[model samples]
Target: MASNTPAPEAPFDAFGGGAGPAAPDTEWNPTEGSLRAENRSGGRHRVVKQRSNFARSSTVLGVGVIAAVGAGGLATAQEKPPVAISLPDLPDMPDLGLPDAHDLPGVGALLPQENHETVAEGRANPNPLTVATYATDDERATKAERAEPVADVQAGAGDAGEALRARILQQAEQQQASADAADKAAAEKAAAEKAAAEAAAKADAAEKAAAEAKAKAAAEAKAKAEAEAKAKAEAAAEAERLAKLGASYSMPLSSYSLSATYMQSGSMWSSGYHTGLDFAAPTGTPLKAVHGATVKSAGWSGSYGYRIVLELSDGTEVWYCHLSSMTVSAGQTVGTGETIGRVGATGNVTGAHLHLEVHTAGGDGIDPAQWLRSKGLSL
Candidate 1:
């Protein structure tokens, strides 16, 4: 068989050994397909590169998004909007009725429009309101007309305050004056009382002195009266005693004639002297003793026929000389007016008579007139 067919050249395998599976063709070629395949491979590489770049870009974008979110949260935490504060409006206040802004208490109104600007400014923006700007004529006039009662009240209050203060001071002064007057009056009264008391004491002393003087004068007068009375009584008693003695010693013969006197000179008697009184009578006429006495001698004497001598206690002797007879003997007591001898002319007698003689204690003849006169009897 030789046929001109080329024997299957032993199955001339393009793969060398036993083929387990069919091998891919190695020498196959397609022109447009190769080109297309090369293009497709390039396209696949480009696409993978693009996919990697896109993944990196996507990761960066996510990180940037997280940072932006974190920054936004931080900015929200750090910064905040300002809060607004609101206030309530104040309420309007009611006005108190007052005078216009220019007036003074007790004074006249001020000039017109004097404090308009100040008052307006103060009302709009009152810093510190004062009373000086209110004392204006226009304001006072306006206030007086509109608010007369308020103006009067303010004025009255001011006047009352001043008056009250003045009254208090005046009262204090009056009280002080009254107290001083009372003290002076009390002192004067005390002085007057003292003076009166002293005057009363002086008057009492004067009265006492007067009483004492009066008492002394009365005593003296009483003493003088008693002395005068005593003298008068003594004189009266002396007169009575004298009268009794004179009556007892009276002479018994009332009509006997005197023939011889005492102290007479005679020629017949010795020494020519007569020492006795003679009472002429007839013979045997009785003779008497002038007073009571004792007889000391009753005998005859030379030239005398008979005689009797009577002695008295007073040292006096009575002698009956030239008697007719002697009746009293010696040592015999004779009473007054008793018979002691008889009337006779004896002892150289010229005629018949009774002779009587008085002799002292010394035996001297004394005048019978003087002796008898001493015994409260008239000679």
Candidate 2:
């Protein structure tokens, strides 16, 4: 008992999926909105296939996703240029490039390129890679400029040292020369002094020899002169004595008789010789002195009985051997021709006579007559 009612069919949208079979197992019943189905295997009726909306809607959604991804990759362009960062300069270094690459012709050359400001010339490399190296070159240039003065100062110091060495050498040479000159001068002075001393010694010896010779000659001359003067004086005194004797003289008696001569032999004489002149006179006859004389002796004698003697001034004695009496005393002065005694023969005689003898001071007898004759008187 089922009821025979049909469900209503829904309205289709262009973008929706289709609904499939609805109820179980019976047979289709066509209603007012139900569609008929076809069987392809059957001869007359076949099933109807519908155009679905899912495939078309999927194609539209895929197109919209591709458009969104392409839009994100193509972003908007920037309004301003990129900002530049200045880096610190690097130290200069040796090149580190490919071997022999720098020798390639024009490899490092800059191409004709533009900047933001337009075409430019003679400017530094526009490549950002060369910026640090250019900064290093500028720093090196500054350092080289600063070191120039110090190098000049070092060069001046070297020259000053050379000058100082030269001056020291010159001073040493001058000192050596001066020392040599001084030594030479000292030697010369010593030699001169020695020569002068030798000359002085020689002169002194010569002078002393001359003085000695002069003294000897003077002594000899003085002795010779003194001897001559003494001889002259002696001769003059002899002459004076002879002159006195010539001026004063006299004979002995007034008168006398000659009895005997000298050196005659006679027996009556005492000495056996007649030593003097004899005079014969009487006992009262006066006996006279031979010269001016002193009475030497008057008295008695042994052989002549009485005797008298008269002494002259030059020490000659005259004797009257026979006398009776003496008229003068001993030591009485008598002039020439003055009576001193009387003649007598009181001794052993043949007759009365006068005996006279002459004696010199040396005790020698001479002839009385001869002595008187020499004194400017004749006996």
Over 126-225, each residue of candidate 1 has an lDDT whose tens digit, in order, gives 3322221122222333544534433433444446555666888999899999999999999999999999999999899999898998888888888778
Q: Write the per-residue lDDT of candidate 2 for residues 1-379, one digit (tens) a residue.
A: 1111322332222233443444455433344333333333343321223333333223333332432222222222111222211111111111222211111122112111222012222433344311111112223435454344323323334455555567778888888889888888988988898888888888888787778777777877777777777777766765565446535665555677788887889777778888888877676787777678988888888886788888888898888886777889898999877777777777767788888889999879998878766675645
- Runs in model 2 lying further than 4 Å from the true structure: 1-247
Task: Say which candidate scores most in lDDT.
Answer: 1
**Model 2 score (lDDT):** 0.56
Model 1 worst lDDT run, 10 consecutive residues: 85-94
Worst 10 residues of 2 by lDDT: 85-94
TM-scores for all candidates: the values are 0.37, 0.35
Highest TM-score scorer: 1
Q: Clashes in model 1: which pairs?
A: 101-134, 102-134, 102-135, 103-134, 110-137
Which regions of candidate 1 are displaced past 4 Å?
1-239
Local distance difference test scores for all models: 0.57, 0.56
